[model samples]
Target: MLRAGDTLVIWRLDRLGRSLKDLIAWVGWLKERKIGLRSLHEAMDTTTPAGKLTFHVFGALAEFERARIRDRTQDGLAAVRARSRKGGRRPVLNVDKHALAVKLYNEREMPIVKICRTMELSKPTLYSYVRAANGVTDGPPAT
Candidate 1:
């Protein structure tokens, strides 16, 4: 239950919910209870008709912004795919380097730290290459 003068605080509207239907339901519930909802960053309040209208406008704007972001992300991914470019961080170890690193670790009795230092890689990166060479489908286990 809510009452007048009670402040309902939210970090952001996005944190409240992702969809317009959810937002409307929450706002409607607050309105029914006479609760004043406020978003710290967005400076929205639902205690007045003007405030309620502003919240609706804000929700619409947020939805539009989310759609635009999703569109741009898809477009970027498509462009990269068209160009045959891989997304995400490039692997630090190529096949030859990975093979050599693994051999040195397994056959030459090289320490993991030494191998990582020689290959100018972090421990995790060196371990991943070693694991791959060992026919382990999964990369280095999560820390």
Candidate 2:
């Protein structure tokens, strides 16, 4: 632990944290309290003016690396978007089945449950078709 007037000396900036962002924030907090940071291997010391420049350079490098990564990722996604047959499962209920379901639902006196069984359609799918055939666009069916 470091007191207000003490310094935190380490072998490398990496020893402070795994990433440059963490190191920058920690160093900023330490700087706020007039607490110094010294990295023995890099000859950088926050107690001196020149050492602050060294960390500024490191921060700039980290920002550049971050921007480069962002640009590359965006480019990769654009390439994927350009590929043929954009992904999603094919429609489960087709035209012929939809027509048959609509007919059974509208025509005979058969129960709705029986119609679903005859068409081999789920209750929800049958309801959706009935709603569409009657031109009801929003919300649950009337009954």
Number of the predicted model whose lDDT against the real structure is largest: 1
Q: Write the per-residue lDDT of candidate 2 for residues 34-135, one digit (tens) a residue.
A: 789888877788888798988767656656666787789778767767885344445546898788778877886788899878777778988888898889
Report how far residue 73 has shifted in candidate 1, in Å: 1.0
Residue pairs with colliding backbones in model 1 are none
Model 1 ranges with Cα > 4 A deviation: 1-6, 32-34, 85-143
Clashes of 1: 0
Tens digit per residue, CA lDDT, model 1, 1-143: 45765878987876665656667877777766677888887888877778788888888777777778888988998999899997667778777887888788887687888888998789887777767667776321122
Candidate 2 residue-wise lDDT at 117: 84
lDDT of each: 0.76, 0.74
Give the residue spans of candidate 2 off by over 4 A.
59-143
TM-scores, each model vs. reference:
0.49, 0.40
**Highest TM-score among the candidates is held by which one?**
1
